[model samples]
Target: MAKRGSRRATATRQQRNGKQEPPLAGWRLWLKRTLVWGTGLAVLALLFLGVAVVFAERSLPSYATLQATQPGQTIVVRARDGSELIELGPSYGQWLDPDQIPQPMKDAMVSVEDRRFYSHFGVDPIGLARAVYVWMTGDRRLGATSTITQQLARNLFLNSNRSLDRKLREGVLAMALELKFSKQEILALYLNKVYFGGGAYGIESASRKFFSHPATHLSVSESAIIAGLVKAPSRYSPTADVDAAVRRANVVLSLMREQGRISASEAAVDPSAVKLKKDTNQNSVRYFTDWALPQLEVLLPDTTEPIEVWTTLDPGMQNAASNAIKANVPKGAQGALVSLDRDGAILAMVGGTDYVTSNYNRATEAMRQPGSAWKLFVYLAALEAGYTPDDRVKDVPVTIDGWSPRNSGGSFAGEMDVRSAFAYSKNTVAAQLGNEVGFGTVASMAKRFGITTPISTYPSMVLGSSEVRVIEMTRAFAEISAGGFTVEPYGIVKVTTTGGQVLYQHEDTRKAQLVPDYVAAGMTDLLQTTVATGTGRAAQIGRPVAGKTGTTSSNKDGWFLGFSSGITTGVWMGRDDAKPVSGLHGGSAPARAFSAYMKVAVKDRPVEQFKTDLKLPEWQMEPDEEHMYGDPGDYYYIDEQGNLVEPNKPDQAGQMPFPPDSEQGSAPGNGQQPQQQPTPAPPSNGRPGDNPQAASDDFLNRATGRGGGTTQRTEPRQSGPRSVTIQPTPQN
Candidate 1:
């Protein structure tokens, strides 16, 4: 039973051991596989948790510390007494209190830029996913997931480089900004920081540029148009292409409707109804701007600061001046006008007929001969030289150093008083007076009057041969209008920061006594006479006015410079090439234009006379005896008997009073008259009665005769009574 039981036991044991061992091996293999799989699952779970942590960290708000540095942008505008006229800016940025921005504009911006802007915390997950999906699908859409806060961050803290890294940075900055600032604050920043083209950076500038109004006044459609430009400003720029801009605006309207930001009915309205104000390029006042530029800089030394320039210019006046020249200027002619206050404050200046055609600034840049208008200086010099208006000067042909000047009509009056000569523009009289007063003296006076150019003391210079610019002449004449106080014309009155910080203020520091008040007054009187009755008659404005007309030689240039109490204006008309203008004269064209302009300019203003207190010296004419005659060919006579004689008639005995003495020593009528008889040949010693001696004494007595005296003559009186007595005349 041991052997048999052992064998059975061995088999059973072996079976059992084999079974157990297989189970153990199987258990080991299963354990090893389970352990390996479990470890892998744990590792994978940890990895996923780490990735989720990273993504969640990215999704959370990143509080980036931004350095809010405002870039330098200047807003230049011309204003006067609380009214704005011309305005220009670089990077059209305008910072406004949130309250100042129209609610419609804000709503439009949110609707177009980011519909979920108000709800998002810097990152819009839905919008981001959509953008990613679109990008992955190769559509390459730029509808970023960035909210307004994020855009503000990108504009404020990040570079504009469009790279993945930059985008991430933008996103991080945006989140940081959102976490640090409220939604309203972010919107305000974004609205002010975004670029709107044409050097405009903010909505305010863009609004003003496009609508010619403030951002606070933007209409719903106007707001929509501006919001639409943020995507691609140049593409939607009203100036670049209005049609394209309108189309883009319509798309914005559609987006607004799709987002429920606007009603479907509203979106259904005609796209044409979304009227965008025309963009004016802000160059209409280029000439005016250029003119005001230097003054602005001078007024505000720090141009980096925003400032307002209070000017004297009225937009209406400027437009009138511009249009007048444009309408009247010939096709080939170029012209300019400068209107200013008597105090030298510039009101309006048109440098050229059109700034687009040329910015040459003919009003201030062009230098040309002023023609007879310069004769005023000659008259002024004469006034200073103790010459009176009534003093007569010969207007006959005159030559100086071989130079003979002719009048405008190539004729001359024999003699004319100063007023008539000046009125008629007699060239000879002007040249003569200029010569007498000394050309250097006149030039010196012109210098005091604000002429900067060198004036040569040549005879022709009296007739305006020296070239001078319109500005110089205008300013010079303004001194006369200002009652002899030299004035420096300036366009800028004051400059200030956009925030109302005063930067600079112009001082009337350029004052000097250019001429005596009385002298200036006299000249003004003469100029007034000119406008009233002389060549400048066309410039008469039915009011107290003073002016001068200028027509350069060859009819190549014409000018009318005049002033009323409140303002002085100068107008010039001529060909750009300096060629002759047919039938053109200052009195005909420019004077008429001047009168027309002044009539409008001074209509509402009070009459202002030059402030002066000096008394004028009285002027009187000098006598000329040589010219007092009837005829050079006529004759008159006195009889030998001391009786008056008539012309072309002979005298009888009684008409001749007494008879001639005979050679015999007695009167012819009575042979021996007691008194006439040779009283007695006194002393024959070669004295009174001696032959040659007596004759010499008689001649001496006759030559030195007193009331009643006698003399002996041998020569027969030609064509009248004969004298028989002969007398020898003394040598000495």
Candidate 2:
């Protein structure tokens, strides 16, 4: 039987190879082998895919954790009344429920991001197939296959990385999210967690940022525009690129119409003509927030938790101060104004002309010469050394170590009381006073008052040659306003965590007495004369104010540092390069700016009188009546000519002919001509011999000395006389 079977097989095989068999027999065998190999390869691909899915699932976050994903919130800054000042860190606006989102906005997002959002189980099989086909075909569009839930999974769990591994991981996470949450929940999380441009973190913040309204108020066109920004927030941002945003919005609208979310007619909504709400908190409050940020770091160091900061900033005063600077500061010139309470609460601070143009906080960072404003410390040193405001000081030409410190106008009224000297901002008198109290004493006073800049013992130190920051000067002045108590200017009042836990609270703990009550009173009275009869007259706000005007040599910087009972303010104006501003003086722009700010700052506040009880000694009688200018009464009413007119005394018309107003511009202490004298001369006690003409010529020549006039030195025949002229003194 085996032999018979073998014979039959051979015969069949022969028949297959012969003409009697079908011609395609060999092709059938090849087709069977190809089928077997293809099936084996398909099973291997399935096994590899299953292994990749398992690995991706292991890499994903837990289901419970994914469902509970919440991004870190923004730090909220609030004004005193709980009104939002600004937000620090990435701001996430209010989160809305799934149904709270507008229908059009949701539809637009669905049409552009994922048309099969509702039908997909986190992963869209049909979309995935289409993507694969397109990718295999090398299509240029490179459309994404991720459903909205898949996008949410990537945004919430995965970082922005374009890799095959991340794609696989994202798919696994999307599946996990779909199992743990509903479609609406996924969409809500996606809308709330996606990052938008310009520091906006979510849909609501993006809506407010682009349209200046809540997400619920977004129109269909606006929704389309917003939806288009999801792919590339910076490139399609309406605020950043209007035309790009319009193109993107049109694309989104077309897609919406194609998806039947909107009709063709409705898709015609004009993106170019769309009304956008103006962005709020753009620059007005940025200055304050910028300043407050450092304080937050100091108050709460190395913190990642969202915090609420209650600041001492007065929004009303901030707006007013900012407006005053914008309105009053001259064009092309920048300005800084700072206001504070007696206890060092920063009320309002305008750091520069515009925070957008420059973030340099001139008010806090600029350390320019305080000019005569620095005299406060010098006089404070004098006061500490038992020098009274009425103590006599010579306002004469002074040459200390080859450096001749001339008065502003170069003309010096003979001897005057310390009060008048400071009020007038006499450079010579201040130099002499600083010398009498010892340079160390003056420097120590400055350090105690928060002046951190290096101070030289040079005679010019008394003339405010030492540079100082505006905030430093303001804080020092606050010490005087607070009855000689130390004041550390602070903005943040309290900080709390988002969970209602108090992190830090500011306390008025600076209780150490920096200046004695008596010294503070004397200083306040002396500075008051500066505003009352001195260079800071322009800063007078029809209230009991005390201040000083300071103009650096050549007008490089101008400052009006003043304080009332309730508030202390400092104003500074100068070019960034420290180049002299033409005709700029402390009393002109700074004093006027201080006045303008205070006018609105102290509105409706009851004016309180400054307490002046530190009794100053009586004025001394004139030593040389002929050479020395008369007392305050004698020169108080000088006319255009050098004639001194007795006030309300018609009979006493010509007691003594004074120098012309040109010789002695304004009062000694007013802002218009700070430290500006008509001439530089010898000491008050020593006069040039009996030649009155020589003295008069010397005064006029010295007054106009800056203008090509030459001066000659002449030694008095007498040896070691008390006073000496600009004429070279005897070398010894």
Candidate 3:
């Protein structure tokens, strides 16, 4: 026994040390490795799945939380000056109990939104499979099949942004909803809370908005229309398009018949029965509220209690912005304006000339080419890459990939300094800068400047082929105005519940610097020069101002973005259909509107000089011989050498004769007459729009902001800013 024990001990020691145990053959060795690796992989997969599950379910609200939320709560909005703007919400209609809801309404909703409402849990795997198949086959005419519970989940807790994780969370919430409430309760919740567009929410409000009645009196055809709206509220709202809404209702009716909820005869829609209400929500600040409301879903998704929103909009500035658009925008064309403070507060926003005629928020929605205003990004990129505003860049004509950008002047001048090129809005120099720095680098520069829109790296993109929203473009200039820090446009300042509970407050903190101080100063130099003696001269208001002008292809879109008096404003004028307006350039009506708006908007704000480091060449505004009969402020550039130049002038006898800020009023936008315009420039080559000039004497006189001032330079204001209902408190 002792001998056997010794032998066993020796074998164990050898196995540990690597000798006694014989190695397994090929199959055994392979099996051992497979088992070890398989176990490791399995552990890793489990860990990853656990993390994913936690991430997906992290933002899900509890069933108790959802139950505690108040229904039909009103959203009250107020402007910066403490005046109420509007009250909007589902509370506009009467809330109905489960039994109070019409049977046809419930049936129609179930038939069109979810066919298997009674059979499936919150999630319907069969429906999901069918949707997947439809998606793979590219046939989406048959809408998605989110169960009533699933729809409740999203409507209650989630926003409109779609993502894979959002879907997962939705599924989990749907299941939780099914576990917490009965199917009938879910249906009632959906029918009451869903948005039916046309500023209507809840079945009762939608019924009144479309058919001038309550939900209880809605017919089967009306029920079908309301059900179809769930798929696309704006597209099917009868108030928006009567014919489309009627057609969608017929489709919903057909589905109801297929589901055995209605007979074929009842499925047919009667166009005569669909009567759209002409009385619209004509709230003057509706554009601002509509834009700010969606942000609430993102900011406080955890709560459903109605809240009061404090926005950054200045009523005076808003009025001035609207009046400017009306005065400057030609008939039949649309215009938008966005004004921002240095901290990114949206001081004023005008989405269109008349929001009553068109509710579309063009200031925040329309994406159009920025034209020469896009040069800001190009020049900013170059400045950051160690190029200076004083550096020489080629402006001679050149083509790339069969595409060549032509200057608005129709010809490119020879080599010129960066500041001169940017001031003159030279297209060739911008294209060359884009190629030198790489188009990708230029795009990155645009992104850095707060342009969130997608930009293609094609050569033409250097010339502003990419579309960008007016608000974002204004935000980009605000960044530069903010002394090189990143700026993000924000409208809402604070939000509080009806019970005075604070839900959200905008935090004021310093943002990351997007560019060095030197680069931003260089950009400022270019912009100031543009407004001082370049294409953006019309935007000047006596005091030093910095701005850029943009005119897209065929004069389809005109823009003027400028900053002064610690305020940055962007103006866009274009046709809604993207069609050309005859002879519209950034310097024409758009700049005129900017001139008029800023003159009044900044009356109370302090005048701040933009920072610049580059030593600009001496230049002066000399009277032009050709435009001698034209309006004053026409001028030509004459260098110190006494030789006439394209865009530069010596500051000798030809110094610009602009009036001081005090001469007009004590500050910008002051309610007083503007001083005389700068000595005019001569017409070069005996052609119109071919001469370098300061702002016309008439435009400089009319440049005003948020106060009482004359805006009539070429066109007069037909009417003042639109009016709105000021609801001081939410109506219960």
Candidate 4:
């Protein structure tokens, strides 16, 4: 009994100890877990507070030191005499105050680019969160998650390269901008800095370029168009893709309506009614500008300001030059025209008939064979080689070092004066002159005339077989018109800063005398005679005109280069494929067009005189006179004294024989009296000369030299004895 009691007591004590230990172990575990979790939560809270402080500090504005470099801006083009031609810009970032920005444009941009732009402080946390979510979902690409202030900050201080580091930098800059500027100021900066396509950077330039109106007057539709361009300028450019632009513009309008910036009715605005008023020469003058820009750079070597180039382009003249070509040239025919002043200032230049068809400016870019136009250089060579206008040269077939040149008509004139040879466009005579003057002399003259191409000292050079640009040719001819002084064509007049400080001015310093004043005058006289009586007769104007007509051998090219007292003009007409123009010759097509254009070009200008003191050599007949008078039997020869010569009498003939008019009856003194010669019966059988009385009347009408004067007969009567009386016989 005593042992059992002791065992029971021990078992109970052990049980009690086990129960207490279980409760203590459970309490210890609960306390440890509570302390650990509470400490971890406190640490996380401190970390969050630190991150917020850093973000808040970053949101404060920070100032940066800029070198104050003037923005790269538009260059204005002016004429030499200080007339505005055009303005060109890569970015239209014109600075304007925030108040100047139209309310409609502002609201439209906000609605389209960032709806919560004004409410956000540079960084849009909600927008960023959304953007992150969208990125995480892989449904949208990452882009700027910033407000207007942030965008302005990026534009002002950040590089354009897109990268994570750049994004971080942009965010830092944006926060700095927000701290520095108020929402209104930041919005204004963004408005002025944003690009609006069409070479327009700011709202002001965008307004003017698109609507031809000021930014202050921009309407909802206009604002929407501008707002749409922010996403993809090229894709929504009104000039580049009108349809896509209209669609995007409508999206902007819809956004405005959705954002309560505009009424639903306003959002229904017809996009079709929107018309983009673009500059007349949007990018069409890029080549001309390119050519002019280098020159401007040279002229204003020290200029940091934008340059203003003034050209003498009469818009009327330029339009006429362009339109005339478009209207007259064939569908595929490419042509160019260059009009310039005597001082080598290019007034109007038509690079191609249609700039939209092809941008290959035939005027300044093409270096094709000048053909007979090249003869002008050859003539310059001849004059330089001591040959005069009256020098005689054989137009008969000739060969020079196995190279024989044929006349244009394929028939030779046998022999002709130098002037007659040039006027008549006798190829054989030109070739002979080239040989006489030595091809090297001609090439030298061409070089002096500004022909930069390599010229061969061969017989073909006489025919302008070498290639040259229309600009170079026009420049050369302008030197002739300017009385032998070589001139460099200039477009820019002066360069100035936006603050009206003069930066650079084009200096006309370099000049060279290519020929003597008299020589230039003599050449002008020859060209004038060409307009009056030569192949260039079609280029004649009421005023004093001098010009040369050129027709390539294969009729593949036609050119007319001429000058008035104040201006020199060059015209070229040919197929782009170099195919021959049918029934087209320089004397007809190009000359006629040149004459037409000059009539208007010189209408108000005073007539100028060419220098005329150049010495000319005396005329001398060739040694063999037989070849000159070979065809003496065909017609009656007469002396300068008006005395009739016997048939086959070459020695007494002072001038070439003249064929008698059919209405003048048979031979004189052949038993035919003037009154009884059957009235000189005209040609019959439906021929042009069928009407004898009509022919006589026509002759009588033309007989009067001046206006409305009666025809007078001036025949000398013989007072000598043995005056032979001839009986008159009537024809049936």
Among these predictions, the greatest TM-score belongs to 3
Residue 623, candidate 3: Cα error in Å is: 42
lDDT of 1 by residue, 624-643 (tens): 33322222212222222112
lDDT agreement of model 2 with the native:
0.72
Question: What TM-score fits each model?
Answer: 0.51, 0.53, 0.67, 0.51
Which segments of candidate 3 are over 4 A away from where they belong?
1-70, 92-107, 118-122, 131-145, 152-201, 216-221, 231-273, 392-394, 615-732
Global CA lDDT of candidate 4, please?
0.65
| Root-mean-square deviation of Cα positions for candidate 4 versus the true structure, in angstroms | 27.6
Candidate 2: Cα lDDT at 103: 90
* Per-residue C-alpha lDDT of model 3 across residues 557-589, encoded as one tens digit per residue: 999999997889999999999999987889989
Candidate 3 residue 636 Cα shift, in angstroms, is 39
Error of 4 at 396 (Å): 0.4
Candidate 1 steric clashes: 9
lDDT against the true structure, per candidate, is: 0.66, 0.72, 0.74, 0.65
- Comparing 1 with 3 on lDDT, the higher-scoring candidate is 3
Kindly indicate the candidate among 1 and 4 with the higher lDDT: 1
Q: Sort by TM-score, best first: what order?
A: 3, 2, 4, 1
Select the stronger candidate by TM-score from 1 and 3: 3
